[model samples]
Target: MDSNLYRLFGDRVRELRETRSVTQEELARRVQLSRASITNIEKGRQRVLLHQLIEIADALDAKPSELMPSPQSQSDPTMRRDVARVVEMLKSEKSRSDK
Candidate 1:
């Protein structure tokens, strides 16, 4: 995957984790990883395997697709907007679920 895509994926993970009020350490534990690994992953300094991606999504209570960045988001401004909109929607949904 493109580094930019990895960065986007990381950003999405951080957003979802924060929205769920989950700490990095907690997330790491859930994913059977170290806190430093979570930090590195969230920083886009570490690339995750496919299984790891699924594990992360499960840890966050999100779908794997939700954790992925749209391939076109890097090239298309409109797609980027769509991705941001979807992220915002997910945040809203999470908040509503908390209420």
Candidate 2:
């Protein structure tokens, strides 16, 4: 995945988390991840798994789509494809979780 995309996603996560007054440690606890993991995620130094992305979004009280980088923001075709793929996976995961 593109570093820029990761950064953008991380930035969104941090922004949303902060807006909700949630600390990294609290978010990690809610998501069942370590605090260090949350730190790495917010720093864009970690590649979040598909399930983890959904979990993080849920923990932050956000929709998965809200946590992702906008496909239109990417100039690279590969990045757009990557984002699209993740969006599809998020939809699938959400449906399953909702069941």
Choose the strongest candidate by lDDT: 2
- lDDT (Cα, tens digit) per residue for candidate 2, span 1-99: 468777777888898999999999999999999999888888888888878887888788777778876667666657656665776676686789889
In the predicted model 1, the residue pairs found to clash are none
Whole-model Cα lDDT of every candidate shown, in order: 0.79, 0.81
lDDT of 1 by residue, 1-99 (tens): 468777877888999999999999999999999999988888888998766776788788987677876656566556555655665566566659879
Q: Output the lDDT of residue 8, model 2.
A: 77
Best by TM-score: 2
Instruction: Write down the lDDT that model 1 would get.
Output: 0.79
Number of backbone collisions per candidate: 0, 0
Model 1 Cα RMSD, 1 decimal: 7.4
